[model samples]
Target: MPMPRRRLILWLATAVISTAALPPLYAQTPPPTVAAAADLKFALEEVAARFERDTGQKLRLVFGSSGNFYSQILQDAPFHLYMSADEGFVFKLADAGKTVDRGRLYAVGRIGVIVPHGSALKADGELKDLAAALKDGRLQKFAIANPEHAPYGARAKEALQHAGLWDAIQPKLVLGENISQTAQFATSGSTQGGVIALSLAKAPSVAKLGEFALIPESWHQPLKQRMVLIKGAPPAARAFYEYIATPAAQEIMVRYGFAMPNEK
Candidate 1:
């Protein structure tokens, strides 16, 4: 029964060849797809780049209004992860049984008033100069993201209302589809100024376009941001979800003007 040595050697050679042809375990991991709120456009890119460099993993980032992303995910968009400027959206997804687990708070965001260079709108005590400019007809237009979806826009509206300037500024206001576009409107000279995410104002490109003053946090509700893994996420997505909590990635977010979740 143990006499077929030539045939046994041939079988062993075939098995070795088949094993060599298979891809390595790491190569088989699918890349992650992430849906992120617009406020994260710059900061998240930096984090994703660093993650790629450190872990050899690539992430596909889709940026939009969190409300829009919420609607899309409900419709079964193929995202592996979701990061929202408002934690409420993540919680909503969890309530609907769309997330693998309860999300974690990532950062707290602040709103700012940005005025393009050479505009009469001075950084005069947050809303005072803006109110004055509007009253005097010196400010033709002001921009903010649409509050129906963008968390930053909702905060902006709340801040303006808290300052008692909402009614006066309403007529002159122009609304962007999202916070990133609101920053663009303010920076592109389409509007003299806008209320946008502080993190965007801190970005180098946006910073050079204008000067920004932080709107008091007391004026609006806290923008407690959060991130979650979608049900059936790939390994890369899980890795990224954990990685953003690491000190290195958290530092990058802090550098971009986001307050750590623990910060006052």
Candidate 2:
């Protein structure tokens, strides 16, 4: 074997070259994680799917109340981006320097009255029928998200107050952890009716179970949805942040009943 020194040297050089050409283990970065508002469950899912198909990028989405996510991000949660149903939370994060910037308003959300089949309550856009029902003792166990943390819940409260029914409905209210859960509560026969995100009410699965009518925009403060990249966000998250503002994604959001930014 010692007689083949030249060939052995050539073989060793080839092995070193191949090893050097191999990519580093760290090169395979995992997909980014995005903390999103619960109202975005259906719409964001579609946009994320489209993003993967178009650009081969993937995102891991976690849906919750925006206010809760805000608190978690302040505690240094691992989310790469945060999408809030309320722009206020995004501004606070930017002020804290927890986000890449002040964030951008992505969409405006709306709340609606949803009633399941055989419910005595009518799916009225105005709270007129709701008022009449409450007056007559026909309303019981109505639902809304917990207003303390959920933007939709807060808006729902405002709308009720606008209709002068907040005090009357409070006693009969069921509070969901988030708006999506509120939608379930609205149609699960647990509650006679509830105010839920219009986006959720528009889903075919949810729509099939109930009738919905949009509460007027003037009834409450606008649900201004905003999104921001977290500090040290990975490239994928940044890409998503940009993609969400694109027309394709906005179209999906619109289909889900979200009013895109800059629209009347």
Assess the local accuracy of residue 112 in candidate 2 as a C-alpha lDDT between 0 and 100.
93
Worst ten in a row by lDDT for model 2: 255-264
Which numbered prediction scores highest in TM-score against the true structure? 2
TM-score of each: 0.88, 0.90
Identify the runs in model 1 with alpha carbons over 4 angstroms from their true place: 1-30
Question: Where does the lowest 10-residue lDDT sum fall in candidate 1?
Answer: 118-127
The TM-score that candidate 1 achieves is 0.88
Model 2 Cα RMSD, Å?
A: 3.5
Instruction: Choose the strongest candidate by lDDT.
Output: 2
Error of 1 at 22 (Å): 7.9
